[model samples]
Target: MSSEEQDPDYRFTLANERTFLAWIRTALALIAGGIAVVQFVPEFGIPGTRHGLSIVLTAGGGVLAALAVRRWQRVQAAMRRNEELPATRVPMLLGGGIFVVTLIVLVILVIWPPVGQ
Candidate 1:
């Protein structure tokens, strides 16, 4: 093993990597959900709503994936330097973003009319 890997707590480093991977998986799931919603869901009463939701979801997922990379890098660097973990704003930001998206989706669902012949 290199000098870098030999230093610091292996368990903590591995845990951090695991957390990063989990976030990436979450982002992938979000991307898949975006595609699924766009492809599988019927159009809403308002024209273009399905497209809007799909765009929003896909964009959010992309942004989150980028954030995951950034967060992982920052944490890894801090660990190498033996510094305290950086303040974690990513989780709060993600939660707030998803909350807003859910509210918007729920509103759209309520407004959407039934699809019938």
Candidate 2:
């Protein structure tokens, strides 16, 4: 019998699916934030900093979005085959990206407050 033919628990499969959906949601939110930042945020401190943040966040979102799908597939396959799931690095990457973006925004706000607030 093929690996896929080996039936896994229904609950596990459903849980995996839910996790995948959650990741997609995260990606969408990040993309929206990026758009809002670039389009709505006023030009602050450095001229290009605003654009740079938007770009970095959007790119990070894109990377995570792709990895989310891939990770789902990978984990699903491992589950089906009854094999140990591989280590995941996505969480680290995602967290680091968020931290870096937050730092940049904080620095910008501190260094040069947006006037007329």
Candidate 3:
């Protein structure tokens, strides 16, 4: 086996790939959530607010997917050079932000719904 292949650092690269996949899955879930909000909310004659919220969620998901790909590349490069892994708290922060926003939207949609069909 090649020296690099046998190197312990190569294991980090595998970990990076797994992390990338996890992010992609998260992005997909965000996208699905957005779609669900758009699809189901309107059935109850929800107001424009739901449409706006769905748009935001969809945009956030797309941005997250793009960022995940970029992060994966950076992690791969860092691994190849045996550098310290890049910090990853940003994704977690973004995820939490998304969750909070989604929850708020859901609560608003449920409690003080728009009047008239």
Candidate 4:
């Protein structure tokens, strides 16, 4: 890489760093949510439903956390090299994962109809 390309504009680098932090925060939130669900939330009517949900949320968070680092590195490298930034499936995957989780909760709620409902 060219000497100039080795260190691109500071603004872009800072922005990339911010994005990485945001993803990390999101992952942390997911992990915390998983813990909260398992600890505080009452069990669903179906066996293992609560634990299953917790596992999915926690695992998704772990995956996102790992992917975020990779994404940060890839973006930083591309920025330094002045190459086109790579596209990512992170948003799509996160959305889909959340959607599936929501569906699971919804199905459980409908089938079990939580207490007093």
Candidate 5:
């Protein structure tokens, strides 16, 4: 076999691995955040908002994680063939958007609670 074909570094497999790990970490953080919000924050009488926020956060994290895994695989395949990396800005934008929206929702929940009868 040729040197380039034998040398793994000739491709971007390492980059793909790093990207996959990053997504996993991001997913874990999101899961933790959701659990904390739902399980712990409620102890302080913030249960109502926390519960809803937890669901949203958890789902968001899951979606991000799934997307990340798929993207990683696609990128890895592209790299192996010496093709350009696929556009990833959309996922980044979506993830960011979810995070910002969640933050805003949490803030609103904290500042103006629901009408508690």
Candidate 6:
């Protein structure tokens, strides 16, 4: 309707919104994981490691939640403006963050093993 920007197709807009919601869900899961770890996971042999990991997970979730909104807005704007979609580092960020967390968890498990094992 605006001279500068036309509305994008409704389907595309809905798809973008769905993606945003998925990201939000993932973010919530991460934050819950952090809480679950602190509440249920056994303490790491290295002092403070469990707490540190929880903090990292919760913080990453918070950051991703913020970035999801930003990415959604940028994509919506680009679609309306008929501009090339913006490049996003979200995938790499999520992958690398998970990779690092997994590596840390692996190391902890190797060094300390599980309590029952």
Task: Give the TM-scores of the predictions, in the order they appear.
Answer: 0.87, 0.89, 0.75, 0.92, 0.72, 0.93
lDDT (CA) per prediction: 0.82, 0.84, 0.76, 0.90, 0.71, 0.91
lDDT of 3 by residue, 9-89 (tens): 556778878988898888888788889878886533345776777777788888889989999987776666666768876
Report the lDDT tens digits of candidate 4 across residue range 2-84: 67677879999999999999999999999999999899988788878888888888988999999999999999999898899
> Model 5, range 1-117, lDDT digits (tens) per residue?
433333336446777788788888888887788898766653323456667678777887898788888998777666556567788774667668778876777677677654462
Q: List the residue pairs that clash in candidate 1.
A: none
Per-residue accuracy of model 2 over 1-117 as CA lDDT, tens digit each: 583556679999999899999998999888888889889998877778778888877887788799999999898888888988878988888888789878878988998866454
Off by over 4 Å in 1: 1-6, 114-117
Q: Tens digit of lDDT per residue, candidate 6, span 16-112? A: 9999999999999999999998999888777688889899889989999999999999999999999999999899989988998899899888988
Measured with C-alpha atoms, the lDDT of residue 18 in candidate 1 is 97
Model 6 misses residue 107 by how many Å? 1.0
Q: Which pairs clash (backbone N, Cα, C closer than 3 Å) in model 5?
A: none
lDDT of model 3 at position 65: 92
> How many clashing residue pairs appear in each of the predictions shown?
0, 0, 0, 0, 0, 0
TM-score of 6: 0.93
Show the lowest summed lDDT stretch of 10 residues, model 1.
Answer: 1-10
Better of 1 and 2 by lDDT: 2
Model 1 lDDT tens row, 1-117: 446543558898799889999999888888898899889988777788878888888887898899898988888888887777889887898899889988887886777763541
Give the best candidate by lDDT: 6
The local distance difference test score of model 5 is 0.71
- Candidates sorted by TM-score, best first: 6, 4, 2, 1, 3, 5
lDDT value, residue 56 of candidate 3:
77
